[model samples]
Target: MFLRPEDAGTVTSPTLIEAAPNEQPVLSGGVTLTGWRKDGSNRLGLPAAAQGQVWVADVPMVGGRALAFRQLWVNGRKAVRARTPNDDNLPRLLTWDVDKQEAWITATAVGTLRQAGQLEMVLHQMWAVNVLRVKTLTVQGAKVRVTFHEPESKVQFEHPWPRPIINGKNGSSAFYLTNAVELLDQPGEWHYDGQRGQVLYWPRPGETMSSAHVVAPVLETLVQVSGSLDQPVAYVQFKGLTFAYTTWLRPSEQGHVPLQAGMYLLDGYSLQQPGTPDKAGLENQAWIGRPPAGVELAGVHHTRFERCQFLHMASAALDYQSSTHNDAVVGCTFRDVAGNGIQLGKFSDEGTETHLPYNPKDEREICTNELLENNLLTDCANEDWGCVGIAAGFVRNTTIRHNEVSQVPYTGISVGWGWTKTANCMRDNRVTANYIHHYAQHTYDVAGIYTLSAQPGTTITENRVEEIGQAPYVHDPDHWFYLYLDEGSAGITVQDNWCPAEKFLANANGPGNVWKNNGPMVANAIKQAAGLEPAYRDLLAEQIKKPAANGAQVKQ
Candidate 1:
C-alpha cells in the first residue's frame, strides 16, 4: 500500500523538544509532523540525535491512499543544502614544533581556531585525504597554536604538479585544516563541537549569521522498499515528491578514502595511478565496494517513480537493485547527490566468484526491462568522483534514453559488467537519444558513455556529447573520449552519435564492435543513410524553436 500527502490529516502536535543525553524520541510510521515550529526553532533537534539512530515516520494506508509527509522543513525553509567542506589555499607554513605535536599556521587572528577540529591534507589524490583531529588550539597575535591528536610524519618525493607537498611520503602529499572553529576563516565554513553542543559558522560574503539557516542531515536513508525474490514488492508508485537530506558517515575502522562517486567503501581506490607511464603501477578499479542509497528498491517489480525530485543526498538517489524488473523512472530530477544519480543492478563479482563453464540455466537473477528516460542529472558524484550519472551492471534489456547529464566528475552513463568477454547475462541494453556533457571533471578514463565486457545486442545511438574531459584539475591521458568500450567489450554497435570531442571513440582491445557514422556530421549522415532528408530537416527546424524540448521537461 502507498499513501500520498493529501490522504492524511495533519495533527496539531506541540513542538518536539530535544531529548536529554542517551534519550531519543521515537516516531511511528503512518503519520506526518512538520519538523519546525513558527518561531524558527527546529521542533526536532536532529543535530543532537545520536549516530546510527533514525527517527522514522510510518505512513498508513487509508482507502488505497498512503499517508505521506510532504517535506522536512528546517529553519523555515527546505533543508537540502550543499555540504562541501569550505577550504582556502594553504597559508605559508611556519615552523613545526615536533615535541608539542603542533604546527604554527600564519593567521590574522585566533578567531575560531580556539575550538577543537580536524586538519586535512590532500597531497596527490583528489578524493583521498589524510585527516587528523585537533586536540588543542591557541591563538596569538598573528600565529595560531594547533595540536594534532597524533604526531605528523614527513617524507619527500617528486611530482610534476606545482602544489606544495606537506608530509609527503614516496611522492604522496597533503596539507589543510577543516571542521574547527579557528579554521572557519572562509565563507560557508562551519563546525560543530559535540562536547559543548555548539555550532559555529562563517557565512559567505554579503551574508550574515543571523540570516543564515544552518541544518545538519540527521537521516541516513529516507525510503527503502525491500522484497525478497519469492515475495517481490509490486505496484508501488512515487510521484512528484521531493526526497532529501540523507547523511553518510565515514567509517571509523579505516581512513577516509572515497572511490568513484564519493562512495565510501571498506576497500576503495582512486582512478589516478602512481608512477609515470614508463614505470606504471597497479591499476585500480573505480569502486570495489558498494554503499547504500537514498531510495532503494530491491526485488521490486512493476513500480514507477515519476516527476520526482532527489537532491542533497549522501548516496545514490535511486538505486534499483537485484531482481527488479519492469520498472520506470521518468521525468525526474537528480542533483547535488554524493553518489550516482540512478544505479541499476549490482556489479558482477560482488560476491563469491562463479567459475567458468557456468550453467546458463542456473536461475540467473538480474534486473531487466528497466527504463530510465527524460531525466536531468547534474552535480552528482560530488563526494564520490568515480561514479556515473547512470550506471548499470549485470542488467538485461534496459533502456536509457532522452536524459540530460552534466557537470558530473566521472562517466555520464555506464553499462555492463565483468572485465572480460564472459557471458554474465548482460545483454540487449539500449542507450539512445541522450545529451551528456561536462563530465570526467575529476576522475579519468571515463566517457559520456562507457561499456564493459561482452554484451551482444547492445546499441549506442543518436546521443549528443560535448565539452568532455575539460576539467582544469585533470591532466592525464585518461581524460579523453565520447564513448569508451573497455576490456573485452564486444558485439556492440555505435552509430549515428553526435560527439564533437577530441576523440570520438576509445576501444580497449574490444573486438566485434561496429562503429558507423559517429562524429560531428552524424546527423547529416543519419538523414542521408535513412533517405529522410526532408523529415530530418523539419525535425531540426522544430527543435530550433524550442531547444528545451529536446531533453527532459523542466518542472515549473
Candidate 2:
C-alpha cells in the first residue's frame, strides 16, 4: 500500500472535508485509454473470428512497463479477460504431480498457442483457487505436460489441504487457460500483451470506439486514512461518496497463491512434525500477505463511513489494516470488487508465522469495537474464490448486524483466524441478524456464517441463510453448510438462525460451543427480522445481477 503523507489528516474538523447533504461525490482512481485502431486495418494478426471485430491500442508506457493492470472498465462495467474455452466449458485435470510441480492434461483441449508462458492456469480446489503461471508447455500426441513458475509452483503443489485437488469428492478438479492472444475469439473481451506493448479489445454489441469511455486502472488505493498508535486520526467522518476503479498489480508481478479469505501466501509448506506448543494437531506453517484495498485505514480511531459506494476495485473494497478501534462502516454499497467486501483487523503479518496466535505487547495493535451495520455487499469476491462478504480476523468487541450479502463466490461471512484452540486477544464479537444468501457461487467447503479459533464470548444468532448457489465445477457439492465452526472455534453460541435444513458443521472444535434452534424449526418471526430491518431493503431493488453457475454474471 502507498503511504500518502502529504494528504490532509488531522484532528481539526475543518481540515477533513465532507460532502454536502444533497451532493454525491465520487473519488475515482482511473485513467482513460485513447487512440483505438481496428485490427483489420493494422498489421496485428488476430484469429479468424476476431479479425474485423477486434480493436487495438498502443499501451502507454509508465516507468518502462506497459501500463500494469488486471482489468478494464468499458462504459462503467468490467470487460471479461480473454480466456480459452470461453465461459463455463472448463477442462478437467487429468493428473497432477506433487513432487515435480507439474500437471498433465488432454493435448487437443488447449489449441497450439504461441505464447506458452503467458497462459495462466486457474485451478479450482475445495476452498480456494490455485493460479499457476505456465512456464513450459510440452505437447505430445494425446497428452500435454505443463510446468509452472515458482514460488507459486512450490506453494500450489506443496501447500496443504486446498492444494491442487485432483480427485475430489465427486469428479476431478477443473481448470482453464487465460491471457493469450489466441483466446480473444469472443466479443466483450480484452487482452494486454507486454511483448508488443499494446492492448486488444473485442467490443460488445452497441459499443463504438469513438464514444466508448474505456478506463484502465493504475492506482491501487484511492484513499488512505493513516495515523500512529500514539496519536491516531480521530473523529473524522465521510458521507455520500463513491470510490471507483482501482486495481492491484502484485498478482501480475509475483504469483498469487491464496491461503484463505484472500490472504495470499508469501511462503508456506506442510510441517513434518504436526504439533506445536499451543496446539497439538497443527500440521502447517505459512507466512501470508494481504491484498490491497481501495480505501484503507490504519491507526485510526472513531472514524466512520456512511452511505458510500465502493465499485470496480480489483481487491478489497474497504479495510481496517491494523490498530483501528471504534470505527463504523454503515449503509455502504460494495459491488464489483474482486476481493473481499469488508476486511477488518489483521489476518497474518508478512513476516509472522500464520498459525501462531497474535498478542501484541501493545493492546492497540488489535482491532476492537468495530461496527459493520446495515451495509449492502454484492458482486464482490467474484474473481477471488478464497474471499468472502465480510471477513474479520482477531477482532474484539465488534458487532456485524443487519447486513444483506449476496452474489459472492465463497463464504458469506468468516470470522476469526489462527485456527488454534488457544486463547489470545479475541473475544466478545457478535454476528447477528444478517441475511446471507446466494453464496458459494463457484467454490465449496463454505457456509453462510463461519468461524475459527478460540474466541471467548462470541455469539451468532438470528441470521437467515439460504440458497447456496450451485456451481458444477466445485470439488464437493455436499461440503457446504449453513453455519460452520471450524477448528478451535470455542465459546461461540449459535442459536435461532433460520435455514432451509439442519446443515451445520463443527469440525475439530475445542470446547464451550452451544447450538440451539438453528434450522427449519426456528420461528418465522425471527427469520422475518433477520436481514436488513425495514429501512435498508431498498438496497435489493438496485438491479444487482446474480452470478450464474457457469461463472458468468446475469440479470437476476
CA lDDT scores, all candidates in order: 0.55, 0.84
lDDT of 1 at 531: 13
**Against the true structure, whose lDDT is highest?**
2
Query: In candidate 1, what are the lDDT values of residues 1-556, reduced to their tens digit?
Result: 1222222222242111222454322211112222221122332222322212222222334356432221222332232221212332224345555445456655542333345434333222432323334456677778876664432221111111122334333222224444433343343434443344334333344543343333344455666777767766666666655566565554211324433333332332223655322223424332235666777887677778765667666667888878888889887777777778988886633342211211135333588899998787878876556678998877889999878788997789988765556565777899988888898876555788888777888999888777765443332445368888876688889888887743755555356788887878776543233211232222212211111111111121
Model 2, 1-556: lDDT tens per residue? 2333344345565134456876656677777788887875543435778888888888877678678788988878899888878866678888999887789988866786644757888788878876778888888788889998877888788778666666767678888888887788899999987788888999999999877778887778877888888767777777877788888877766778898999998888888989888878778888999999999999888788887888888999999989999889888889999999999998978988888888789999999999999999999997788799999998999999999999999999999999888897889999999999999998899999999998989999999999998888888888999999998899999999999999999998889999998999999998899878677777667643222112221111
TM-score of 1: 0.64
- Residue 290 in model 1: lDDT: 61
lDDT of 1 at 176: 46
* Candidate 1 off by > 4 Å: 1-117, 120-177, 205-213, 251-287, 348-350, 353-364, 475-478, 505-507, 524-556
How many Å off is the CA of 407 in candidate 2? Answer: 0.6
Give all candidate RMSDs, comma-separated: 12.7, 4.8
| Cα error, candidate 2, residue 114 (Å) | 4.7
What is the clash count of model 2?
Answer: 0
lDDT of 2 at 507: 94
